[model samples]
Target: MKEFDFIRTLKKLSPLPWERTVGNDSAFFKLKHKRGLISKDILLEDQHFFSSIPADALAYKSLAVNISDIVSDGGTPRAFLIGLGASSNHFSILSALFESLYKYARQWNIPIIGGDTVYSDKLLLSITCLGDAPQNPWFRKNARLGDYLYITGTLGSSAWGLSKIPTLGHELSDPHIKRHLYPPLYLDFPSLFKNKIHAAIDISDGFYQDLTHLLEESNLSAVITPETLPLDPSLPPEAKNTALRGGEDYELLFASPLAPSSRRWPPNLQKIPIAPIGKIIN
Candidate 1:
């Protein structure tokens, strides 16, 4: 018997939510919330992202991608509702996926309010993240030309880790693999929440592409420095280009006046490596 996939079957259901490729908000009602509107994207087989990845990994990836939008917009993810399609065949994997969602949701202090489940041929996860800010959310347009440029963690580490699984030398733990498996959300949104961060985003897509959203929205330009960027130490010289351009690190990229380098933060943000990747020029 051929393997059943939830996503494959979910797509075949009658009255698909999306409308003809023009202007469509037919499924908008499903996104309603109290403090903020909800956002969701359904992934069918071979769609959204690479299809060959594991189900649990896919579940986390689905959440990461959706939350990235909320993080970039400076909203605290209050909760999420995951719509799942998993048949008996994939139930184990699907269970692991939802379990991971609960893990992350709890870690982030967000709730898994509710969702729908259905039988499907292949796995499909339609995740919706809900969040809001006091004022209008942080956006690509708020970047100031002279504001400081900053980012969290090294660039391309996730992509690099996946491509080159480092030799597990005397190491007992697998944080690196876990990182690839479950991309971490910094949650230290001081920049956005404090209004101290000027231009900000999470590196969900490749760093090279996503930053453009900020520049274009701000009607400004940028100049990234080769040295200041935090790249993976394991990356050879040949792979630097791909690492820099290949996003998905999901680290935060925001502009703020130098954070307190004098003292340490409980879980601090470093000042180094986060150099002037580029300037928002007038």
Candidate 2:
């Protein structure tokens, strides 16, 4: 199928609010009251993933990474624009990709509005996700001196999975490698935590590095007890070191005054494991 044909299928599957005029010069989106947020992420062949990875997984990751950004700011994704670069014979792969993309869009209630496509040497995808914030969005700069530093889900699991990707040959069934290919999404965090969180960020660039970003933005320092840090039980000692430096986990790291010990999370989030790794220090 061609680009236009695939786009038409997307409109049929999950049409955007303004998709009636999508085929024109540009797409249009409008919202009242709530603030709009947008984030873009570029995934490339070899640089981001091996060619052995399946197209559907690639498509999901492309959209999920962008959604991670929206979630970090306490927002709900509304729509997305996809810029695809691939060769002629990639139509079948593109079909599988669109199927996965549209499926996730419907599940998230977001639409694939519009984008540009071109022929490239290798498969390249750039996704721009747009979202709406119900209230004031969280930012790293808002962290308070006494705020607790927390992480949702496990860290370094993705790195551990990445290490095995070369040996396992892009196998998604393996639990370890699967984490690298499909990082967990924290969409419910914004809704569950609500306005309690003062600052937030997605751990796309590993724990320590992204933590540094948070601290830098807040003009504060933090003390993270290595022993308290959450590591995958399956990871070896060597993997622990890589987990701190490795990237692409997509887990959320937020600063909040809410005491994790005193509060009981909703039953649905108990399985995800939210833990305090450290506390901000002036």
- RMSD of every prediction: 7.5, 2.9
| Residue pairs that clash (backbone atoms under 3 angstroms), model 2 | none
For all candidates in order, the CA lDDT equals 0.62, 0.80
lDDT of 2 by residue, 55-168 (tens): 778977888999999999888887888887776556567667777877787787778777876667678888999888767788878899988988888888888888888887
Q: Model 1, stretches more than 4 Å misplaced?
A: 1-37, 44-56, 164-177, 190-193, 257-276
TM-score of each: 0.73, 0.90
- By TM-score, the best candidate is 2
lDDT at position 255, candidate 2: 92
lDDT of 1 by residue, 2-26 (tens): 3445444433341222222124422
Regions of candidate 2 where Cα sits further than 4 Å from its true position: 1-21, 32-34, 263-268
**What lDDT is reached at residue 22 by model 2?**
48
